[model samples]
Target: MSDALLSLENIRTDIAQYHILKGVSFSVPRGQVTMLLGRNGVGKTTSLRTIMGLWQAKEGTLTFDGADITGAPISARARAGIGFVPEDMGIFGDLSVEENMVLAATNGMPDPARLEWLFSAFPALRTFWKSQAGALSGGQKQMLSIARAMIEDRKLYLIDEPTKGLAPAIISTMVGALRTLKQQGATVLMVEQNFSVAKALGDQAVVMDDGVVVWTGAMAELAESSALQERLMGLSMEAH
Candidate 1:
C-alpha cells in the first residue's frame, strides 16, 4: 500500500527454541483500521509484540511512515509515534485512573481538551478519576487502557483484542470508542477474534495461519463471503 503507515516485510520472530512468526508480512494503510485475524496460538499476539519491539524480529524489515525502524528500541518506537495496547491491557492496578492517564501523557500532563473528549467517550474514566484502577470492572479497565493510549496522538496504534471476553453492552461501548478514533483519522492495526467487531471497524483484513499471512484484502470483501472467512479463519462470520 502506497499510503501505508506501517509495513512489516517477511517478519520472523522466535521465542527461545520456538519459532512464532514465520515470515509474516502486511501493511497498515494510513488513517484506517486493519484487522489481524487468526485463531488461538497462530502468532497474532507475537506479531503485535514484534512490531512494538517487545519481541525483536530475527529477520525482515519494519518501516513506519517511510522510515526503517527494524532495529529501534521500544522506547524509540513509542517516541516515533506508535502506541501499543497489549492483550493484558497493561494497566497499573495500584494507581488511580487519573494517575494512569497522566503517566501515559508524554508531557506529564494530558491536554485538557483531549481529556474531556476521552471522558465524554468513556464516562467511567471521568467517574473514577481519583479511584484506584484495580477497583474498576474488567470492561472499565479495558477502557482505561485504550484511553491511556489515546491520551497522546500517535501515527499508528497496535491494539490486541479490545473487545475480548466482554459482555455485549461493553463491546458496544468499545466499538463506539474505536469508531471515534477512526473519525479522528487515527491509524490502527488491531488483532481481534470477534468477527462482528472486525467487520464493523476494519477497512482492511489480514488473516494469519500457523505463523504466516494467509490472506489480505478489503474487510468488506471478506465479510461478504462466508466461504472466504471459513477458509481463512476456520469459521464463518455468523459463527461469531
Candidate 2:
C-alpha cells in the first residue's frame, strides 16, 4: 500500500512488574495482512493489547492513519476505526448471535447490503443469527468474533488468533474469510501460532521472541526457508 493504516515504532511495555514488549516495531500497509509469528509466551498477545491501549506501553509511538494514538484509550482506538479480535474471541456468550451483532451496531447501521455481503462470505453465521453465542461451535464463535470486528467501516483489524481450535476444513474456511477481508481492503495485523494458517494468508511475517520483534519479511520467504522457521518459530515438519 502507498500509505500505512497503522504503525508501531519501537514499543516497550510492562505488566505487573514483568517487562513484556521490548522495542517492538512494525506497520500494516493499507489492505494487507501482517502476521505476527512466534512461539507461545513470546509476547505476541501483549503486542496486540498494547496496540489497542489495553496495556499501556512504557515507550513507543503508535500511529493510526498518521495520528499519534499511543496513549488513546481502548474505546477511543475502537472509535478511530480499529477493530480487535483477541485470542479469546471476545464473544458475549449471554447474547444471541443476532444480539451480539446488535451490540455493535451504531454509526454504522446494520445495512442490508453489508450484512448480506458478510452473510454471503460466512453462511454459518447467517445460520445461527438467532442462536445464543455460547451455544455455537468453536468455528461458529470464531466467525461471530470476526464478523463483529468487521461491522463498522473499520480501517484496521487487530486479530490475535482466528484459527486456534478449528478443524482443518474450518481453518481453510477462516483463511478464505481472511482473504475476502483483504480483498475488501481491510488492513489486518494478525497473531498466529499455526504456521500453515499464517503462511497461507499473510503477506508479511513479524517474528517476535521474548517480547520483541526479531525478524520480519514476506510470507514466501518465511515458508521456503525451513531453517528460519525452525530457529525463529520452533517449527519442524516432516516430508509427506
Which candidate number has the best lDDT? 1
Deviation of model 1 at 184, angstroms: 1.0
Clashing pairs in 2: none
Root-mean-square deviation of Cα positions for candidate 2 versus the true structure, in angstroms: 1.8
Cα lDDT of model 1 by residue, 1-240, tens digit: 539889999999999999999999999999999999989999999999999999999999999999999999999999999999998999999999999999999999999999999998899999999999999999999999999999988999999999988889989989999999999999999999999999999999999999999999999999999989888888886688
> Would you estimate the TM-scores of all the predictions?
0.98, 0.94
**Between which residue pairs do clashes occur in model 1?**
none
Encode model 2's per-residue lDDT on 37-140: one tens digit a residue. Answer: 88889899999999898999899899899899999998999888888998898999998988888787665357677788779878988899888999999988
lDDT accuracy of residue 90 in candidate 1: 99
Clashes of 1: 0
Give the C-alpha miss distance for residue 158 in model 1, angstroms: 0.7
| Cα shift from native, residue 82, model 1 (Å) | 0.4
